[model samples]
Target: MANSDNNNKTAWQMATQVIHAGSGHDDPHGALAAPLYQTSTFKFANTEQGSARFAGEEGGYIYSRLGNPTTHELETRVAVLEGYDAAAATATGMGAIAATTMAFVKAGDHIVVSDAIYGCSFALFSELFERFGVHADFVDLTDADALTTALKDNTRLVFLESPANPHLKLVDIEAVSQILAGRDIKLIVDNTFMTPLLQQPKQLGADLVIHSATKFLNGHGDVVAGIVCGSADDIALIKGTTLKDMGATISPHDAWLILRGLKTLDVRMQRHCENAEKVADFLHKHSLVRKVYYPGLAEHPNHSLIGTQMRHAGAVIAFELDGDEAQSRYFLNQLQMIPLAVSLGDAETLIQHPASMTHSPYTPEARQKAGISDTLVRIAVGLEAAQDIIADLSQALQSSQQRWQRSA
Candidate 1:
């Protein structure tokens, strides 16, 4: 059972927190697992109780949209993992991004963003934020001078991703945080790739940490969710306004699924890193592979920084093909075991061509600027035996090279 008290989390290690962060949960039926409290509405004892709950004077559920005991369990556990005062879950990973943006900035504000982020995030910043009169500047955050030059007086937030998506470019969270320390700007980190098991952004001075819970926190690939963890005051404002008004709260069942997945996070990540290291080494030696972007590889520019921030090199790897996009697509199509897919962090190894798929939103010029090439292939290495994973990739690369040579 959970302690229901936030302090209880500080006493246990991460592995223990997954099972016990929200443990003191109670149900009329006395079920040990967090009860699903599936209904939409809760009864108020009286007018005073109802008013207090709405006013934030008391803690109780009035509506599932606003709060639910089952969802709260997941929130508490995630908050503890991210080392934040509070967490809010959303209907989907993108919702977390949307809610956080809406909660923080408004018209006339500017944002300095990193170049290597999710495709949808780029769209939200470039398309949606632009329409609202809010401005955004996308720069290679690895270049500290560029980041500093891009910042404007009206810059309301500095958003970044460490070991960024697709290419694995890392932004120095502590360095960036210190730059904003005396300023009024908030520093938000998209911590989806590292998961708290490997890195805690808040501990490194991030004001808020966001996760695509759909990818990792719900590791089974069966649920779609997102989490934003931050100070209690900020989360309360987001919960009451942005999430509530936008109707992006997570479902109780999805929250429970994430809670279940959290239990084995430690073990899963350990294996993921182990398998990824071997797979990266294999790709590096292969003739058809041009370059591999994984922090574990000493060749990776951010290799040293991984040791500074993350516990492991992480599971996803992006590599360029010695051939063109056609060969890359052929390589993906030739894979027998690992499925060609979009989303990452699944129990099964998933691979995809980022140029034609995840990063399709960018034009050829924009893609190059973002460090994504047409021949780039991303592998979300899963928990399969490292040998088998290597075999599948080896055969696929060979097949693609042969086909390309014959065509040439």
Candidate 2:
């Protein structure tokens, strides 16, 4: 596969970009779908060509680990969609995070991370990086004053997620970018929850934008991959350093699946947003639900950022049960349709308890400080009919509340 001239045009809308971007169908047969080059290594035309490729005097791929046509196409499509100069696909969401961080930061450098982020990400910064002498401060990035106060001369990077994981708390990306402006500190955003359809962090002044392609990008739960988009220079630095050395490259097959998944992303995301809003509304009005954390609700603390920061309130929703952890477990068990799973952005609705599942990497004190409550439940609303999902929730909540009453 080769780059398509059509993909470079900025005028193409996102829907078209998702389908046609990075696809020239330039294979020998001119296949409408991009061909997957699954081989581990590419044969050189000759010894001279192979040496030239290794010496950077040539342009074609020499190794799949270094780069694959299939993965390259995925990277290009994502880069164009994200409005970045370049991109790199990784084996997992954590691989993307690790490559991006390791490419830029060194030992003794300081990083400021959102107090609320994905559970494994918290562990990566707090544990893995700490052993390397990289210090991280988990700060409330939603607080502009706190963000400003937390930055030090040694601060090399600031990382956060908008509509953050498990809790759905939001960070003001533009404001945080401005605070770090001219300071030479890189601002990295994990855009997994929003997807490029709902938000473009680069448009907001972020230096790099990353996604767990495993989630909404794949839309189906079958694949696990990730991508990072940034300026060509930054992406090159990453590709040359940690991504190349650590070798967490995405497989060609997974890249192809993500490409297949991308074609339906626009429609899937619209459905997800619609379904999530309906579910959030239902949860908000339920007597058994203590509080809803969806930004789509008018009363949500970060609802004001919707139009300016993100196109819509995304698919994931987090809420507190009007009961204890045991009651929360009872409600989860009573549910008949939604599966109790960790990952989101699938065809079927999925739910999880962050404190006990995803965010368990944090200690009890850290989890409390991060606002991941014991009774909080997160759901990735699926493509099912809105009424059906709500009915399922209603029955489960009613049953759990009745059981709690009986036990009480």
Q: TM-score for each prediction?
A: 0.95, 0.96
The CA lDDT of each predicted structure is 0.86, 0.91
lDDT (tens digit, per residue) of candidate 2 on 1-408? 002333223323888899988885469886888898989999998999999999999899999989999999999999999999899999999999999998889998999999999999999999999999999999999899999999999999999999898888888899999999999899999999998888889989999999999999899899999999999999999998899999999999999999999999988988998899889989999888889999889888888888778888899999999889988988998989999999999999999888999999999999999889999999999999999999899999889878988998
Q: State residue 131's C-alpha deviation in candidate 1, in Å.
A: 0.3
Relative to the true structure, candidate 2 has a C-alpha RMSD (angstroms) of: 4.1
Candidate 2 clashes between residue pairs 3 or more apart in a chain or in different chains: none
Candidate 1 Cα errors over 4 Å, as ranges: 1-12
Q: Mind giving the per-residue lDDT tens digits that candidate 1 earns over 301-361?
A: 7777765577678899999888778778888899999999988888999998887888887
Which 10-residue span in candidate 1 carries the lowest summed lDDT?
1-10
Report each candidate's C-alpha RMSD, comma-separated, in the order given: 4.0, 4.1
Ten contiguous residues minimizing lDDT sum, candidate 2: 1-10
